[model samples]
Target chain A: MSNCIDFYFDYSSPYGYLACERIEAIAAKSGCTVVWHPILLGAVFKITGQKPLTESPLRGDYAVRDFSRSAREHQLEYQHPAQFPIGAIAASRASLWLRDNSDPQLRAKTADFIHAIYRAYFSAGQDITDATVIAAVAGSLDIDSEALLLAIATQAVKDSLRIEIEQAISAGVFGSPTMIVNNEPFWGHDRLEQMERWISSGGW
Target chain B: MSNCIDFYFDYSSPYGYLACERIEAIAAKSGCTVVWHPILLGAVFKITGQKPLTESPLRGDYAVRDFSRSAREHQLEYQHPAQFPIGAIAASRASLWLRDNSDPQLRAKTADFIHAIYRAYFSAGQDITDATVIAAVAGSLDIDSEALLLAIATQAVKDSLRIEIEQAISAGVFGSPTMIVNNEPFWGHDRLEQMERWISSGGW
Candidate 1:
């Protein structure tokens, strides 16, 4: 098995944002690398017949409370996004474009771009569904904002994200913040510790 | 805001079984008592539009795997029941009957019966949906098996369980192993640690 963790997440997922903030440290502790795969939960939900957490009946209220409580437990900053559960298509496409960039420097900034976008939406309550908002977040991190905006709008980048979501669904990922280590899937941000234990113990 | 943890769970829920094995110590650590509420997820699912974890599409396979893996993580023995996702109506009724008994000693055996029923189903692969199976498990604990069976079969016991499920849904409990500490709902067994922190730190 590869010493890499495949981290699957949706930009609009609060748990996904929380996982992105903590997965790196958990991965580094066991000498493992994290491979981030940004996907659309909306697409996965179509097959899984699931709805957004905040839109569900009873779970909706608990999910909103858990989002901030979980973040505080991890000592991470979180604020409820004004417009949540957004499409996040532009941000997801931007992440994939950055990761697949030919330039190693831009590729290395993929994680940064992901964190920035998540922080912008979850911490600062920004509307990340807007391409310009995504571009501005990228620009703040020394990335070429205009290029990213253009790249995400291209059919190739959009298709790349579509394929990634399909692959994620095929791999048995039905939720955000799913971490796969050694081909075993752990879903939810709550499974991070279990995922770490699986890595440190070399599978239990 | 009571100094007690209202633990709502379904007998057929694997995570609920796992939580049952650990909640007391967590409660005791913070000088809190645990009030076990045996709920029917099937009823809640009717309103929440959720299916059993092991019945969902991609999540089904992962839930099956997570059941045993999570059990192992907690160092608890687990065997998947041959007839999974059983109704567990009999066990739930029996649990309520035991808890509401006039005799204090029989009322005290409520926890024992809860553990026995869960262990029989999850650890020993017994069909807890059967009233006779539930009775036999209760008999092993020195409880009056005949009386228990008769009690669980009564309209009163059945109504009690129905009312309990209604109350659980009213309180926003849509899943198994939901622990409500100080009126704050923490769903899933994985949140036990956060629940403990909430107890120890008096909320964040």
Candidate 2:
């Protein structure tokens, strides 16, 4: 049986972006596949009654310090994401629509698009809240930028987001970059290694 | 004004119990007061999209490894708490009432209560889920065990628990053993030093 990890991601999260980048390598090494599910992180928070990281100064301050520690531990290149809490709604919708095509390379291409958007926001310090950056991301994916834009423009994407939020709540998901394998949810980027460990243990 | 750290605690949590023992010493040295708040960790999980440590095999696995490391680093005498997800409701309700009595010796006494409870559960392999054990904890306080039991039997105590839960959700808390000073929450025992730093800075 093929082992799969269902990843719930939001483009605005630096850890989500980092996890997206690192998980594939980890998954490949562990003989597992990542199933990407893009959902609005803001909505997840609203439904779950979570305040932003900025609310608990510890969360924000520790996030800054913790990410530094994590990057070093993982041996990944990371600096603080320049514009935090960047608008992720658009990208989330686009990725949901992209899944309908169901191409085998869909997950990889979508990851690339998401990674590029993260770079644009965190590294390039561009306005990911701007539609042009999103369109550029879709264009780079060779996905029809116009159709993708139109799809996100409709309520279809919005409704999909609603369902995703509800499902995540029901599943007891609390934070970003959650990996669910075999009905179990693994939270946080730091947990990626444990996910690999579980897979190597035969996806128990 | 004496600096205060708003403390989030659950009775059956060995870490919460251990922290109560050490925090007093740490605070005395650092010079701060622990304003204890009895909150249900279950409610924190419900609202914050978090799962109990019991639910995440990966988190549970990591916690075991991490606690072993923390034990060494903090120079703590720790044996991992067994019979986890033990009913903490009684403990929190007991603490809420205990704090109200305002005995001059509450701080030191509270630390002793926590130490005995943690050691009983972790080292002595006692079932803290048993009411007899809980009654013994109450007895250790020298209050009439029956009166303490009767006090925890009220609707008012449950309401106080609810209010504490609401406050934690409002404060953006997502985990246990969270410390707060002047409405600033510093989560995890690891962030205790930063909580101290924030108090010194007057940046709030």
DockQ by candidate, in order = 0.81, 0.06
Model 1 lDDT tens row, A1-204? 458999999988999999999989988887889999999888888877888878878988889988988999889999998887788888889899989999999999999999999999988878888777887898898999999888888999989998999899889999999998878999999888878878777776
Which residue pairs of candidate 1 clash?
Answer: none
Residue-pair clashes per candidate: 0, 2
True contacts kept of each: 0.86, 0.00
The lDDT values for all models are 0.89, 0.67
Show the lowest summed lDDT stretch of 10 residues, model 1 chain A. Answer: A195-204
TM-score of 2: 0.57
Task: Say which docking band candidate 2 falls in.
Answer: incorrect
Instruction: Report how far residue A29 has shifted in candidate 2, in Å.
Output: 2.3
